[model samples]
Target: MVSHDPAPADPLSLHGVVPPTVTAFHDDESLDEETTAAHARFVVDRGVHGVFPLGTNGEFPLLSDDERDRVVEAVVDEVGGEVPVIAGVGAPSTHRTIARAEHAASVGADGIVVVTPYYYPLDGRAALDHYRAVADAVSLPLYIYHIPSKTGNELSLSTLSELAAIDAVAGVKDSSKNVPWLAQAIDGHPELTFLAGSDSLVFTGLEIGCSGAVSAVANAFPELVVDCYEAYADGDEERARELQSTMFEVRDAFKAGGAYMSGVKTALRLREFDAGPLRSPLRLKDEEATAELRDRLESIDDLEW
Candidate 1:
């Protein structure tokens, strides 16, 4: 196993609104590189601190290896170094995960977002070892992705601390949504950075020392999300809370739909972005639901694409 310790040079700390990009698909659900690159550039142009492609919000699991590489390359080339692009590089298998990480590095990704190995339950030691192997395999900075609800394996605080000690493990995306644990993680490792994995928790996360969030809601409303962070950063608690409350309606609307990717795609289409639809087995939101989403968004006039 690789040793976890501070690297000789600390990687860039993840801060502000980093939207986990949604993959653009054609009507037949084939990868749409042009639309994908356009969406990526759209977010960057709207002023998010960074763009994270192929994350859970990006439907990472649905994408094949080649598709993943193409999307990452498209985003990298489009952004052209305007902002950091952290490519998702997680797989149920360690070797495959490492290969994805290496690919991200080779393609000039700023960093990698790696989730704990899923499909099998893993204890702390196993989790530690898995991440260590991946970290050892690549030299680029890594942000540990901890979403226990989806993976069925929670990254305990001890595991996070252990990973934080790794030279290449720069930070973590704590999707736990457990506020107490988030606070504990922040207090325990003041030196390590954390990004909230949920939209509802972004403000609270920042209040408790988390750097920022990789928000799903940011995909639909980039400006509002960025405003919340800027408001909190400037210590305008009331304004931040107000903006956050407005986003709650949209966030809840996303949850009401069976699958959020479809809702997001529909919303993008509503905005004339042509994000297409979700792949098989994931149906688009019903017309009624899409109408509700449109109504909810209409109230928030400041929201940008």
Candidate 2:
């Protein structure tokens, strides 16, 4: 494999609202490819810049290898070149991650999102080696999925700079909840597209030189999310701030209800989609949380698009 620093395209090419779409299941917990694609169609139709599936929000770690690839294929087929589709191929093993990246490429994903290998803590050098190997393995551009809270592997800023120098690393999705770090990272490397993974930071991220966000709230309010970005882009700072605040409120409400992914599924079910039950070790037993989400969504629904 060659190591070449291609001239950065826009330095913010992978911007805007891209949802890590939730996988749909039937009553019996069978993979519901139809509804999964339908939700992708829903968000794309509502005007997102891209679609990502099989992230933490999408239950990637919980899914079988076959399920992961199938979800990517279904979304790609349904999206049909309408929007760039980035599929998460993060696995604890580098071998499995490579296989997932290859499968994503074969299934028509525009790029791949790779989270650092978890379960055991790794130093900067080890993480760099892992990403470099995967970068060499696939031609599709790779975006680092840096969510330490769930993965137990926190990527340091210095380490991130080293990783960014690699030829194939196109961007990063920062879910560390560190605005200062995000701002500093974006400034440090203006070449790699930086995307915030938190909804509350959409406006702040963009304001601080981030291209856009890879969001969970976007699974429900695609239009609203895009509108917020558009507002910021259009120079309506006030409008953008207002929308961001609303999304922050929604985020807090969802947090109050239950966990991250489950609340997102609850939002989908509220809007009349078939988001079905969560997989094992997880259950939708919180009616109070669901009702809270419903009311909050209703308030959002009443907001003018």
Best by lDDT: 2
lDDT of each: 0.82, 0.83
lDDT of 2 by residue, 1-305 (tens): 11112226533267788999888888888899998899899899889998998887788888899999899999999995787898999999999999999999887888899998999899999999999999999888899999899889999999999998998899988999888888788878877888888897888888777778888888877877888988888888899889898888778766765776677777777777767888876766388888876776667642443
Total backbone collisions, model 1: 4
Clashing pairs in 2: none
Model 1, global lDDT? 0.82
- Model 1, span 112-143: residue lDDT tens: 99988888999999888888999899888888
- Would you list the clashing residue pairs of candidate 1? 4-165, 4-166, 5-165, 5-166
| CA shift of 195, model 2, Å | 0.3
- Stretches > 4 Å off in candidate 1: 1-10, 301-305
